[model samples]
Target: MTRPIFAATPVNTPVHGLSAFGDLKYPAGFKQFDYANPDAPKGGIIRLQPGDWLFNQNTNTFNTLNTFVRTGSAPPRMELCFDSLMSGSLDEPDTIYGLVAETVTISEDRNSFTFRLRPEARFHDGSRITAEDVAFSYDLLKRDGHPTFQLILAEMAAAEALSDGEFRLTFSGQQSERTILAASTFPILSKKELATKKFDSGHLQPFLGSGPYRVGRFSAGRFIEYERVEDDWARNLPFRNGLYLFDIIRIDSFSDRNAAFEAFKKGETEWRGEFTASVWATEYDFPAVLDGRVIKREFPEDQRPSFYCKAINQRRERFRDLRVRQAIARCFDFEWINRNIFYGLYRRNQSPFESSPYKAEGLPGPEELAILEPLRGKIPEEAFGEAVVQPTTDGTGNDRRNLREAARLMHEAGWTLKDGFLHNEKGERFTVEYLVNDETFLRISPGFIRNLRSIGIDATIRQVDPSQYQLRLIDFEFDMIDVAFSLGATPTRDTLMQFFHSSTANLPGSNNYVGMADEAVDQLVDIAARADNRQDFTIAMKCLDRVLRARLDWIPNWGSANRRVAFWDKFGFREPKPDYGFPVEALWWYDEEKAKAIGK
Candidate 1:
């Protein structure tokens, strides 16, 4: 007896006024200003100013948002200019508090979830947020949003309004706890306002958002200006209040990071994420830091994800053999790369879920063995029964010992050394082409290539422009490539499945560039997805991690211990959180008096 919930009449809520759903309450320690507080100043603009251009045309839809050329930078910038229904802790996993939603409840069976709308929540145009808007937002994103959006919600059968201010969304399968958290990404949009404007390629002009900031003006290629949304409904939400203290947020787009750094120094921008060692050690001897107009600080990041070595065309003919893949992993000189190019600013990743609760470390404990024993003959014995050895750095620059091991493994895989070249039984030399996007990788990858060459294997490095690199990646037209996969705040087996499963590999723009297809891994991911509770989910995820690590499907790279960033001292930040990245936009604010003292 499942039925789609629906509202019979269009609720004629005033567009420029607020309506009540129920009693409005703010989170603890949240003090609502009377819209007259001098400290909470009314009008000014804040500039985010990113070192990248907006590449995609569709900013209103999620489906094409990932395809946007500014994929690396836009999301962080847009985060300041939008609102999500739910907000997670700046500290721990599974610590989500309500934002746009007043209360979120999951049904006993876990197939359906209901979100009660906040009473006073309103869009930028001042239309009341009702259940209809939430349902419309879900429908639009599910129907026309990016493929990833659709794939993420593949199990969601329908969404409907259950009451005046409550909406229910039902999934086709047993809902994992992660599903509710994932809903936070689906920003709620106002349907009435959207219907008035012509959505060009799904891009909305004068982007109406219900967040702390509202888009004010845009100079196109130069900068997009945003002013604080005074009396913002979700500001007092537990995750936000006392956050976004700036009066304005301006996003200045630039083509180059170096130029952006120079702009920050010249007082054009306020912050920059330091990626180069030269700047890390040398930059910021300015009058700003001495006068407390700017502060230079380094905060350690826990659970920082890895920048991994992704295999392209995994289902393709050449990389089908797990032995060949393992040999390729053994060929890399991780020790050299960590010491030299990265300035030892990274740690080698041991598992896809490294640093998370799901990472399987040490020998299998009895409880873990119980889970493994049941799948004894179904999965590889090395996957369940063996201990994962810690990686070592051979004193020699080439990591000669590891190279020798790689050569031996390749040889055992029917590859033979002939005329100082390793060749398969058919006499084809074991040649691999490595594609990279940056100059740093061009310098770093050669060390590994040299190791391969020393072992009588041929490996070449191909450097391409960023655009060309992305094109090649989407086409799966490379042998080996450097890529990083991002997992959700709460790690799950779905993270592994999305990156290695056979089904995703066949789909375009999916993370499964590895084309991993084993019956056991597939079963583990399915079991993990259907897990009833947190404890069961963790057990399932750890089991999947053990299996994936043993297979060595991806050669792990190093993760940064801290987010290396440089910003004008006029802003302040809280202590770093565990699961979240630098919540810069959430925690940081402009020291207006200090900013005025160093007037532009």
Candidate 2:
């Protein structure tokens, strides 16, 4: 006899997936995501140096195993060991399908959501995953997880277990309608394992998980390996099919990018996502690329807007004036940096919402005007005019016109050049420090610093270790920093709040790197969150984008249109990666035949 998968059927009709503003791509009972290769072979190891990371993860090094908290550096891919109620799709913008959950029932008012857990879900310790575990996970993350989690879970009124198989989450009315999309994807911790442990501790202890992989061999700061669970309960699930196929996925940490690239060259690591443009153009001529052992390729980036920029800390009194911030932004010469330093491979970034439909362009439309009309005199006056665009330079390292404008702005802000330094009315020198973990900035930052110094401002670059850099960022102790973020195609309210909300401005470990605490931006975020339809949401977001660009809180940098990657030739991956993400760790698999042919 076949065992039942669910307890009692939900009282309301259950859905297999949730969408923010569109129909579900896969209906109930769908076999697998279209991008997944269900028939792909699953074995062998894939070693990589992760170029991107999320939350508390540091790509260079780690000290703690608990990535859910904000105290210490956590290794990349720590989330692979934990299972969530729902998992997202790479092909869709803002949608999720059940993973640990078999189905979900939405209340009529939509503030409440009930999830029916699959009876087969089990933790690594062979303990049954009950609804109580899910409730515990949410409560723990809300109470003591990273500040990012605390900010996102602020709208969740409560999480409760109705039965062994049923978990319900109720949200406060202040929450956006689409907040559930993010809430459902949080990693569900095993209450039995983490309940007794310090949830806020930065120790390197292993936490119980119910996902397809578990932490295997790990050295504190050098490398961590995840061994695939041979008897994973969700191996055959529709949402999990053909994913997490590697038997062993290993991540190695290096103190710098060049060191990681050298390791990649020595075959210590098999894959690397190239971040340095000059290195991509000049390097890779090593033996691996000379033959065909290594393949250099560019993959399409997801549809989300690429947010790469330098954030000026508004919390500093020296940077409080709008004119001061605008003057500082004018010092960065993107055209010269792109041509000389980056090998002309990057495009100048203009808006934080770059490459997306919400990027404000030309003048505000009538709908956007309708959203901005009420906020007149409250927001920047430039918001109603043509959208703010970065000034164009002549591609020379020194652009006289832009520098002249910058000097005028500085003078208006009461910063005058005296004794070879820009000093404000308070007799304090205008000093700015660019803090970075990677030494690559040592080469790229000199030109920008020269421009800042040319305008009589004292600007310097400081490179610290990755751990120290992360700690400084967490404590909001930097004058300026270079960073990038991958945003969702359909951004949720919580996502925007983590980056630009007033509530998170002073919250430790929050993503509000610019320390933005604008009342107008907060109201605009609320408008965007309340938008029920896609068209209305787009208008509100565009309105917000216009205002944010004019504020110059973040000095937009440069970004590439494609993902530059180099990997060994022994692996096989499906063509045409997903539109929303390309999780090579989960989607690509080892090919024994190809490995033999390539002599790997």
Candidate 3:
């Protein structure tokens, strides 16, 4: 096919739905998400054991309803309370469906975006959603929202309301690549609501929203519930079809996971997403399981890396060199941890982007080479060859080969064992301390600590309260910490900016706690977001994955490829989960008949 030529001042293209990469799955006016069960029943109650943390809140207990603010924890599923200009597709990467906005027009240069809101778009209070609301929301969020929300909207230079229902946002055209997808995904708040409420602090009052459900009832330290509105303004919209099925979604709070697990056995909770591998293997022997009233299931995990690893702080001079980091990494016996501690429930995770299309494996291909060629002198020469792979053990804790290798690497890095202590030329002993918050990590750390001890490193573990743990992490006051995060389903500029960008390296409370300030990484992050096509995106992502893996400051860990869940036999869900989502509570419809049968 021949391509057409464009004028010097390129014209904007109008699209019903927009995608960050290319081509949308659903064209304009598509009835519903193909992944949804259009005819699924909706009603009844679905009780869930409240997750330990709500979104990125610092603590397990929540004190306020305002998630966007920095003072308190957001309620579970608080995001569902308000609709955004566009909603993301669970099954696809970097795609968004129109919600309040009917259609979007992007300038040819990809610097400006205009969204025409649907005239019928209304808030839960029956007020029309206006362009002013969108504009105000942007300003409010950037000025007073949480750091995470601020990071999400960092690229927009300005926003304006042209008329009644048309909103326009212009980009800064700075180094940061801007995308409509980022703007669309943020929750749109009502300008009127903003004037009457305090958004920068904790509140017990109900939050104003424009989505299918609203806060129903809550006992601060005990439980929270969301009740569905039958006449929800956007219930029949293509983007919202077959979602929020439960009439009442109840989340019960427990002191901790152990108490919640006990409640699951006693038939108090309807669903449980189990994370502990040992519990999944050994538990579930109650009468309900024996009588077939309960069921256990596992769904495929998303392709993105779990980011679950031991984050070694390279800001400390001890872990500065790659050789030192690698030597410390070799001491971690992943095979033994999986077999004995995790009950053979996980696979060793390597690259930060492991298990995804972005995962870097084998050698760098031509596209990756294109990205790497410019950084030859800056990066390690070995990075151009086979991707780094962590050491393997024979499911045994005491492996002579790995220990010897660790010792050899340590020696090469100018360290030697002397009188049961690793000492440098200055006679300073090698010592490390792990700051942890959870009991599960407590069980896992002993093994690695033993390995470090064997190599003559004085290692110790300190358990801190959640509040203190959060404070320490914010201050970058730990030698090592266990951390895991996803770069989202689609790796965007925001992901890199928050996690690896040099500007954020020294920023307190930023995700770059590793203190890695490399120009090469920042460039790859920029290139990945600015790619013109999927092929370009893949090339950038692959190269970025390779470069990040080569850093060696991360001790690769393990995660299950499946979501371990067990629930009562009373709900139905769409088969074949989305590539980037596992929407059990959102998509699963309650079956009253099945519940009655189980009761009998």
Candidate 4:
């Protein structure tokens, strides 16, 4: 019973007048915007510029921000907020479909779970949501949250609050239904408001929340308000009944994104899309999208489990050679970065479950080699017997058979080529480096480091600063880096054992920063975290995606067909689901005189 492999495909329908800024003019019936406008007004002030703020509050420290009491630029002090007991499919991924836990109940010996807590939930000081505030916010996020928040409550083992609304928890091994849907990042706080507010981080207040907004005013690096609670006991759940609907919700913080898209094109901001693509194909064509006051949409989401590749550093001993990591994964060209820097709108991801449904592609058939022939020969028999190929750049420009199969796998890994460079057998030379952080990898790693110095392999690209690029990625001190690993919307196996586990190597900012261990990827991530159904979690996630595409530990990039927003047509929105984003608290307020008599 192992058929799975489905590769996805089917998309192609955007050719009647194009325009994601490239052949404009095609508007007619995209009008639907009265985001609750009692005469178009509610309370103004919306500035936001977030590209990183929240300098430190020790959200109970996880992997960085070493000890802090206060360092804010505001926003990150919500008293309690989490509700969604089931609403998915706007594409699905910002998981948690069950709001204030109204039903969880797992235990068919998958090791306990329970939940059941919606007795008219409360807490904005109206106090109610019990189960001992969800077992005291899981024993204070397993003692000061974020170390992957106790790897999603590491086999929990006893959380019991069986009364006051019943909770349970229990797990010592095998429970993970993505750890009970990551108990929606557990935020139920207020065990008597942190025992009378001495909860440090410069004790900012606002400790009471049954969510749907409440805080109502803060001013740390300027601006923080939030109000709309209107008696919100998990407001009829289902992806939050009509969500926050702003009765006032400000955030305002800017570091820059072209001065917050010029304060969202001078309206001071009431939502702005993630611009840049030269302000989404040339700054909002003023007169607000030809006089509608601004509305530039581009939905088509489902691809963001981010991975724009080029990582390597396999404990960097010249990338610990699997033929120089399959010749640097066949020297990147990703169809020339999807037709010149992602305008052709990306694709190509090859595994670590790209676009999910447990990606496996080809080879391993025979019921996936009967669950990968019990890790026969312990993994790489061309990853369970071949078929993962795909590197063909024939755009006529040249990737010449992936640069002659990356110079015949770096001259059969002993690396020789000489005068043309490659070296090794102690002549040394091989080189590599490549660490970048932008200017599009200083323009695609200098044409892929001039095709790895035309096959004699030298590579280079450095560029730092993002705190010296998080101190050379927490001192694994580079040899290849180009990050991006977002994934989490049931892309489990504990998110591929927290990124290629070797016990999350040197845990620092741990997402197993590429130190990849493998006992057949730790027994197919422990049989896809105790499978038990969904056809044994698609046969242990297609045998951990055929041993992570035969351990080429990352060389998969591109995916993000579109999210590209640009708000302000007054607000109101819809079409967006997958890793959800602009629900901007259920927008509302776009009846500009009935959208100027329907020319919106």
Which candidate number maximizes lDDT? Answer: 2
Measured by TM-score, the strongest candidate is: 2
Q: Candidate 4: what lDDT? A: 0.57
lDDT of 3: 0.78
lDDT of 3 by residue, 1-600 (tens): 211111111347656776655567887789888788779898988887643343335434556677776555555677767888888888787777778888777766666778899998888888999999999999898788766567766767888999888998887766245345666778888899879877864687766788888889987756788889788888889876887788988777664567878888888888898878888888888889889898988888776555678888878888888888887888899998888878888888887776678888899988789889999978877779898888798667878798888888888898888999899999999989988877777787788889888988888988876556766887789999977776566777876787778877776667777888889888888888777666777878888878878886677788767878899998888788888776677878988889899982
Better of 2 and 3 by lDDT: 2
Model 3 worst lDDT run, 10 consecutive residues = 1-10
lDDT on C-alpha atoms for all candidate structures: 0.60, 0.87, 0.78, 0.57
Model 2, position 533, has a per-residue lDDT of: 66
Model 2 misses residue 233 by how many Å? 0.4
Alpha-carbon RMSD, each predicted model = 6.9, 4.4, 3.1, 22.4
Error of 1 at 375 (Å): 2.8
The candidates, ranked best first by lDDT, are 2, 3, 1, 4
Which residue pairs in candidate 2 collide? none
lDDT of 1 by residue, 204-311 (tens): 255467878776666544566666777787665544456667676765655445566667777677766665554565666767666666557666655633435556
For each candidate in turn, the TM-score is 0.80, 0.97, 0.92, 0.32
